[model samples]
Target: MYFGKKNSEEPEIIMEDTIVYACGSADCNGWMRKDFASENYDCPMCGSQLVEEVRELPKIENEYNAFK
Candidate 1:
């Protein structure tokens, strides 16, 4: 790695508590935000049942998930 000047203008993010759906299977790591979830849907990665949970996530200013 080459040495370079470190920029100090990186934006700071605010953490917020949000509800999300997580896979019920212990071996699966699939999860999604609440608003992006569909009713009665299972984990998209492992097809396991989903459970509701709360997580601290990076706050969004104006961007939103376009798939919803």
Candidate 2:
């Protein structure tokens, strides 16, 4: 007996250590990667100040990844 075809599974989820600029507001839900954030250092969603935080987040999939 032999296997006809191997099942192709999705690529494993990749996690990465990334720095993010999160909203300082306690009641706001806003966060973004530091690299993609605005230079003004403000939350794009709630007009609040942003703070730096180190977090382990899922790898983001984007066109830019092709260059890496």
Q: Best candidate, lDDT-wise? A: 1
Per residue, candidate 1 scores C-alpha lDDT tens digits across 1-68 of 98898898998888999989999999999999887787867999989999999999997643466633
**Candidate 2 lDDT tens digits, 1-68:** 98788778877889999999989999997999976765789888888999999999988866664685
Error of 2 at 63 (Å): 6.0
Clash pairs (backbone) in predicted model 2: none
Cα-based TM-score, every candidate: 0.73, 0.71
lDDT scores in order = 0.87, 0.85
Q: What stretches of model 1 exceed 4 Å from their correct place?
A: 1-7, 61-68
Q: Quote the positional error of residue 46 for candidate 2 in Å.
A: 1.6
